[model samples]
Target: MENRRSRRAAAAAVALITALLTLVGALTAPAAAAPPPLPYVHGGQTVPTYSYADAVRESVQVDTHLDSDHDGKPDTVAVDVVRPRTTTRVPVIMEASPYYSCCGRGNESQVKTYDQHGTILSMPLAYDNYFVPRGYAFVAVDLVGTNRSTGCGDVGGPAEIGSVEAVIDWLNGRGTARYRDGRTASPGWTTGRVGMIGKSWDGTLANGVAATGVPGLKTIVPVSGISSWYDYMRLDGVPRATDYPGWLASAVNGRPAGTCDAVQSDLNTAGDDATGDYNDFWAARDYVRDASKVRASVLIAHGLNDQNVFARNFSRWWDALAAHHVPRKLWLHQEGHTDPFDIDRGAWMTMLHRWFDYWLQGIHNGVMSGPKVRVERAPRQWQQQADYPAPGARPVRLGLGAGDGGAGTIDTGRGSGTVTLTDNPNLTETQAVGDPNTARADRAAFLATAFSGTTHLSGTPTVTLRFRSDKPDTELTAKLVDYGTAARDDYLANDLSGIENLATRSCWGESTADDSACYLDTTEIVRTTDYGVLSRGWTDAAHHTGLTRYTPVTPGRWYSITIRLQPQDQLLAAGHHLGLVLSLSDEENTTPSGTGANVTVDLTHSTLSLPVAGATHLGTATTAPRLTGTAPAAPATRSTPTRLLP
Candidate 1:
């Protein structure tokens, strides 16, 4: 029995020694590290694993290389940041804007709120609340000369573009920044991947910044944004508004009065409202020219009826991006100057989430495998297509034929005659388009016979006119009209912005006491009018040759000019007629030249080009319609007067 006990004790000692050795190895040897907290993925989307309520909120001042305000110091832009609380690195979604403090953001006009320490307590939109918990950071940056940034507003010039570029550089560790207390600010927890997004001026900044080919910027979603400042202020060679740049700069600047007087003055001078010519000043702000340098993928959203920014901005940028073979997607809605979120919340959110996941988080969400374009064919009715200008669109040319009264015929065959109309600067568009058969002295109206089959128009229309003006200079307007009684999205209603806020509210993401994710619901304004304006074009007769320089027009000299109307995607039902109205001085969109010139058009030399989809010909018209008596006035609406500013 004693021998057995000794053997057991020896075995116990050996067992104890082995266990201690293992413990020491675990404590002293290189430990097997616990995996870092990674984002969770399910159904091809990043799930909310991080706590949004516990997200880190902070502010920093990014140092820009410009002294736009000329205060003997380098300019700085204000940046408000909200990030997940995890220690793991994450990508960023940024929106740089000039409207954060003054005009506010979104349908509810939510602005950033601050704590006593100047830290951001609440961000303007639901982007932070919705994206933070998904392991992504949301950043709101003030453009130069706006909000707390120390600089002058350059009105889409170098200073504004550079300021935004500086922030992206800082995120990638190539630029400098600091906290409110003057301590150095470092984005140590970020992976340096960024995706930008915004609407109006905010989205304009995104387009400008992405054109710089800035590193660390992965993608951008520019909604109703301008690609060229010159295009925004001028069409062809006619100024949309006088001193527009200065007025806009003053409107958005948060600094004290006279702080940016010199800058604003320079903006007005360089814009050259008198000549309305494209100069070096305008070239610097044209992002479409630099599209080849863009490395970030682009996702564009614009309203077909967005007169504020116009459809050409997105269409031109889309074409430039395609020329470079950049990864891209497009969303064209029916509402005017409105967000897709307000148009179709669920679908927009889903598409946005997937886009960010695939581009920013490197997730294979198959978003790129879907259609490249999604257009709202009708109110709340979306159609997916492979490309825009619809795959089979072809231009059909129709010759103008003078008929009895002011009305004329449009068909494949040309007619002989000279049509004359006097310039009336004070005439409104409503009066110009009224009763096409009335033989108005100030406008010439032409109509096509009822269509035998449904016809679709998917691109821009061009009108070529050989005409003579009695005066030295005149402003001309061309409009494409759809004459029918039908319910349509009232882009002309709701202050020309195409939406009305409802009393009810809807919540998007998690909320805090300081910031709620609920925003006022919005609905599309609808109106059933006898006729709808489909597209319009404006031009200065002196700019017939080029937009770069002004050529004086000699009285009685016939000039051939081509005007490109705004882009459109419309489906004309059978039995509906298409009409074209040519008039002088669109009082609604342009400042009248007041030349009062008598314009004469040779019908045989003028033609209208339509981008008809899936059709080789528009089919000839038999006769023009002439309705008697004055047309009925449109019903009264709650729409406010349209403004030039977005």
Candidate 2:
């Protein structure tokens, strides 16, 4: 009996030794170095401060030969701790990009990869370093593909966001083996809150991910972002006319088009997927624009001059969110598919800090207690209101008669005596004037073609009209202008008179010096006629083109169309009035080309349904002021902006 017991004890000893050996092996074995760290490159140089992509690369680190979940290929991802602000352990910000920024230079074809990654421009750009000192660790993700990471690039859906959520999971010490606690430290504290950010491509991704309502993600800053690729990129309610080729020339074709090509190709070839008439595919992607589902706090910034994406797009989202009682804020400026607030990138960084602070740090930095909106009043100024346009903008409607007589005759009733609409001005070049890439000195002249008069406009402007087309199809182009006088053609008092028009000065950030020092004498302000920087936006009416072209139309016919210009809060200098220029076109609105394509029109029979700021119709506040508190600190900001990141 004694011998048998001794033998049993020896067997137990052998089992214990084997277990110890396995433990030592795990500790001593060198884990593979993560996917070769993404080369810290930026603007043609290997930058160290740009080391924020490290955590991103680490989280999806690749191993051996294959994936375990039956995903076809081995997973390759890594997470680089993009330090936003300094701290022992700080909240994380996921910088979602369609394609990595390491490759954004123009291709020989003049094509840009940005349109596909437009969301990236919406987030905190290369300013991750700014967050490091403020107690946040910003991360730049390579998405599913486009870099060393694995998996195909999915725009904004379950797969891509699930990948991101996986990263969040790892931070909290879940599903990870490289940590002190047998698994990585899935701390309840750190991963309890996370924030999302992106511009354009990244912006859409951030907003999409927020829909998942991950426990850690509490806020998202979606700038110039699109909610639905199908709706925003193409198809407005009818079959698309293979319209925005820019999606291919500028968005895809460049470096490695990736999934963008798949999406765009699908559109280019989809003969039946034309307009979003019934909202089919659009309904699936437009989440935020239909809010009962979105509960996270949001800060939306948009580009007023964004004809491509259109500033008014945010309107759909704002209105929907308001209805659902979702907490939100906004900041719009005169920019094209980009951030105008970036004049002072730090200002962007500042906002990021505050947002993350409120949601992640649980700090009462006033972001949660601040106004519902803060907008940049154009013609050069900024304003803050508890809500957008402040409760008393008062909608004003001024009739746009059929004549260049400087006085738009009002037709209170229908068919007064003029041709209100027709088709003539159709070409794509208006979007190229200040377009840095193709701005011919001469092309600048034709841009302000029909631009004259200072018709006043406040708040958001939506033009409702009544008309009949002389043809089955007709096009309309409208530009909202702040009519101000030319700055001076003779160059008499030019500040750089000696050096010509080369006045070297950094001028982009928001300034509120009372217009006295920066006085824009709008009273005497008139169109520059040749080189005025008038703010404007446009929309095409192909969807509502009531059959005119290749078809038949009597001499005395009529049609109905509504051209809604982008919204604005521009301050018309005291004497300066807001104006709208309407004309006909025969082609797609692919280019921002100037007016005058020609068909014909009957002025007397036209009517316009515009909004004015009078006593009867100022959009009334639906409820008592929900905002009442002292102004908070100047919110956190981002980094340097413009072509002169100087």
Candidate 3:
């Protein structure tokens, strides 16, 4: 019996030893890594952990009609894309720009990067660096005729719009896309939804594309974009400063001048340099005229004082969108020709992120439920409202006269007077206000009595002059100014002038090995104890008959012309005065008409009307006591502005 029990114990011990050996093997052996989460859901706030280094980097060449190189085959537009490493399909955010190849983008001017074999490594502007990890594809397209593309840059013409449309078509499997080596590129990983965004010229492309009613485009965000190329170059059928179309085409084409000499010549002639009338060239590029074709939702941002693209571009576009009942929002600021990212990065990013997530991912995050318009109250102060131009703004006419209470008199009463001013090419805006004690023949000045309380001007103002010109055609310019004693933000002069020392450099968002991005975060300097030109407007007296057709004025015939100033949203402080400065020409910015003429105004029937936000009646107070306020700081060293290429 003892021998049988010992044999059974030995068998049990062998089983225990086998179990221990299996456990040891499992621990020592390397385990397989877990698979990535599948089927990424849209509108999810949690960012996925995808390796950016392993992200897909590629370029696609789409076909276009522009034979920029004069090759037999159709020219190609280069589209460089950076997307997530995952296989899940996602929407795209594209920026089609001519400046990508030459001037670059942002404050530091970063250009596209390529390898030795001409493979694109990265595109400009850190959009990919931020959105790729969030399951989005960032596409930087080289406008036809620029960079590695094979077309003559038309500077916002058919080639520009058609080339970008091809890319959207290719993504949706309606067109073709090929790699640099001529191999077919399959865009099966994209969800066929695209949102085009850009600032300045880039933004102008967005406006043009949206106006085409492209299928795949879901939305557009045009910052400081132009609605009409003609407006950018001319105002009221008159050249603003230079021959913009020909000059811009040459500026973007960085190749040998001989390569595009033919195109440039065509531009010069087609531009109608002799007569500043609207022709086929300007008609084809007017997006506002084609606003009916815009199906995609829009979110436009522009500075109120942007002289480069001007506020008229956005205001006119907004009016069209409203008429069409298109979904749209606006972010109007006080800075001049600047990006919101540089002014308020945190808020801009938050709003932009939410905007994309809602539009692209179909996230119902209440973005559409929010206010449709947000306007800048001051330099950095912002306010939200239901609509723009404040809702119920009306006009109040201020008559001009030649007597003591006449010049600078802005009231409802009509007065009789005759004032003559000649063209002065050398007259500065400061001098255009005219000496209060003396009369100047070079300009005419009319000032309103000091305000007794705060007043906001929220809409466009008009100056109707019943005057007779001594010449066949005359150049008339008018400026609206806020003459106050306290310090105010000089948004005009400080926009491109703020110099940031590297000592003040700061980083924005997550950084990667490929792109180490840092931006200048600083407040724009303010100029104290000065006058701010609220708005400026100009018109060719000949265009009053009709913008398209010129009606040469018979010399000495009295003609009534209405010049509309750029719209504004500004507060006139207590005791501050409003100045209406009229001159024959603006030497600093306007074209020299060379046709010297004396403009005589008949004050009896002429008036300047201002649209004050809430005033039902025009109030005049000459003895209003000045409100007390602290003095503004002295001007600092003028900072160099980081010029952005359009």
Best by lDDT: 1
Q: How do the predictions measure up, each by TM-score?
A: 0.93, 0.62, 0.88
Q: Write the per-residue lDDT of candidate 3 for residues 1-646, one digit (tens) a residue.
A: 8989999999999999999999999999899888544444444552545655677889889876556556567978888988888778889999998887688887667788887767777666667766777778888998887887777777788878888888888888888888989999999999899999999999999999999999999999999999998777777866765556767887888556587778777877887756678888988889999999999999999888777787889988999999998899998888777777767777887778778877887767777886898888666678987777887777887777664422445556674577887877667665665344245778776766667788878888999999898898878898887767655555546445222324476664445666654666756545565466789888888887767877778789999999878888877887677777788777555564657888898978888888877853346533212222312212322232212245
Clashes in predicted model 1: 0
| CA shift of 216, model 3, Å | 0.6
Q: In terms of lDDT, which candidate is stronger, 2 or 3?
A: 3
Over the stretch 271-367, how does candidate 1's per-residue lDDT look in tens digits? 9988888999999999999999999999999999987898999989999999999999999998898899888887898899999999998888799
C-alpha lDDT score of every prediction, in listed order:
0.86, 0.44, 0.76
What is the full ranking by lDDT, best candidate first?
1, 3, 2
Model 3, residue 466: distance off in Å is 1.0
Q: Candidate 2's residue-wise lDDT over 535-627, tens digit each? A: 333333445543111222333354455555556654444333233445554234322222332333343433334443323211211111111
Give the Å shift of residue 346 in candidate 3: 0.5
Error of 1 at 515 (Å): 0.7
